[model samples]
Target: MSIASAIVLFMVIWFMTFLIVIPFRIDTQGDLGEIVPGTHAGSPQNHHLKKKAWITTGITLVLWVIIGGTIVSGVISVRDIDLFGRMGPEGSMWHSESGSAAE
Candidate 1:
């Protein structure tokens, strides 16, 4: 993938992980029986956002490395996942199978 694509992929992964981790180990007002007079019961008393963000970053980094490496190394390619056969027959200028550009 290009540099821009790699960055985009990382951002997407990070945000996804953040969303999934947000509710974990949370201390909601209702759960802790400390609901403020003006606040809803479901409101968080201690969200630990900073800690969750760091945890998300760590998880996303590991996922990005494995996914990015697969893309860069071409283990699973676009054509391989083409469900409707949109890419047509595979052809490359640099063919590793025959070790020649022109057959």
Candidate 2:
């Protein structure tokens, strides 16, 4: 893949991993029974964002390496996923064998 594509792919993976990691090991003020006067009870007592960010980065890096390797090795390709056989020369990006947009 090109540099731009690789960078974009890494970013997407990182953010997705971050979302998955955010809800884990969370400590809300309500759970801690230490709600501050001005803040909502559900507010995070300690986000540990820096730790989660590092974890997310590590997980995303591993995932990106696997996916990028597959892409480079052609273990998966657009044609392999063209379930309707709509990715050949006779078909446009969105066209299927019926000569219309793929469902």
Candidate 3:
């Protein structure tokens, strides 16, 4: 993969991780208040859940950054030439053995 492609892939992974983990962070009063119906406010279980969510979000963000940075930088060293044999010789579909002229 090229640097640009790797960057795009990293962005996609980062975006997906953000979308999945953002809902878990209880950084606001509204998030804390969205518990089960009739549940007591400021309960131990609620606080624990919020803490766990924040931790998970932090871990995910850290991992995403580390992995994405490594992947993007690694891809930067890749050559621009195509490694696959898709271009054929001289940019023509027919081989020399076929004795076919370029159309």
TM-score list, all predictions:
0.84, 0.82, 0.32
Name the runs in model 3 displaced over 4 angstroms.
27-103
Q: Which is superior by lDDT, 1 or 3?
A: 1
| 1-103 per-residue lDDT for model 1 (tens digits) | 9999999999999999999999899899999998899999999999999999999999999999999999999999888887986554577535454356465
- Residue-pair clashes per prediction, in order, are 0, 0, 0
Indicate whether candidate 1 or candidate 2 has the larger TM-score. Answer: 1
Lowest lDDT block of 10, candidate 1:
92-101
lDDT against the true structure, each candidate: 0.90, 0.89, 0.57
| Model 3 C-alpha lDDT per residue in residues 1-103, reported as the tens digit of each score | 4678756765676567656665553344344565555655443333355555555667666776777676556754333354864445655656455466663
Model 2: CA > 4 A from native: 89-103
Spell out the clash pairs found in candidate 2. Answer: none
- lDDT by residue for model 2 over 7-72, one digit each (tens)? 999999999999999998889999999999999999999899999999999999999999989998
**Best-fitting candidate, scored by TM-score:** 1
lDDT of 2 at 69: 93
Model 3 scores worst on lDDT over the 10 consecutive residues at: 39-48
Worst 10 residues of 2 by lDDT: 88-97
